[model samples]
Target: MSPIEALDFVGVALFAATGALAASRKQLDVIGFLFLAAVTGIGGGTARDLMLGVPVFWVERPAHVLACAATAVLVYFTAHLLESRYRLLLWLDAMALAAYGVFGAYKGLAVTGSATVAVVMGVLTGTLGGIIRDVVAREPSVLLRQEIYVAAAALGAATFLLLDRAGLPLWVTAGGGFAAALILRGGTIRYG
Candidate 1:
């Protein structure tokens, strides 16, 4: 698979773990784990795909769904081993958010060819799933502009676009963007 596609799938699994963590926190059943995992894994990409006038990714590749389900099951069975499960969830979310931000901006550049829209799409791709997850899980939405969640995504997306425009290699741009996002979100998760 291409690097972008791999990044997307990695986000799927990591976000699935985040979803499963949420379900575990709520003391939900296996079904809840499955439901939340699938939703959180694909929610942002599905929305971005729709807006981009493309097919939803998970529909085109059922393996993504399977990955989500498997991650949920793994979390269900193994979450108790972690010292602080919520911290794991936050860190995992940061990683996935960064990867998804780069992937989304790259996809947006390929699709819309507009740096502005690409950045917006990247932000949406990174944050929409968590927003939906929080809403469904009955938690406060992170998009209340109260934190650096979306800002980190925006920074990552913008970083990618700028690097691309500067003629940097795609992988380098992706890496830079990912690091930008992870560092930004990680700082907040650690301090806030």
Candidate 2:
């Protein structure tokens, strides 16, 4: 698979895992986990695609749905090890945020050839899943946090764009983008 598609898969899986954790926190059953996973996995991409006037990916390719559900089931079985580890969820979300941010920026640039639009799509893909997760979980939104979130996404997106413009390989630009995001969010986790 291409780097972009692989990153998208990783982002979706990470978000789905976090969703499963949220479901466990809510004392939800397997079905609830599945629902949350689906919502968290597809919500941002769905919105992004709809806005871009493209086909919603999961609808066109059902494998994405299966991946989300399968991730939920795996997390459900392993919830015991993850209980009381919301920090892990945040870290996982951070990774998801980074991966999706890169993928989204690349996609946006591919379609529109606009760096500005790419940044917006990157941030949207990065954080929208967590927003939906919080909304569905009835928890306070991450947008309310003072620590880095959207900023990290934007930084990553911009970094990716810059690196891409420099004619770096896709893997290098994407890895740099991911590192940018993780470093920013890591500081937040450490300092906050």
Q: What lDDT does the true structure give each of the candidates?
A: 0.89, 0.89
Model 1: per-residue Cα lDDT over 1-192, one tens digit each: 766677888888888899999998898999999999999999999999999998988888788899999999999999878898888988998998998998999988999899888999999999988998999999777677446999999999999899999998877888899999999999988887
Q: How well does candidate 2 match the true structure in TM-score terms?
A: 0.96
- Give each model a TM-score: 0.96, 0.96
lDDT of 2 by residue, 107-179 (tens): 8998889999999999998889999999989988887874489999898899999999999999899989989
Candidate 1 lDDT score relative to the true structure: 0.89
Q: Which stretches of candidate 1 lie over 4 Å from their true place?
A: none
Q: For model 2, give the 10-residue run with minimal summed lDDT.
A: 79-88
Count of backbone collisions within predicted model 1: 0
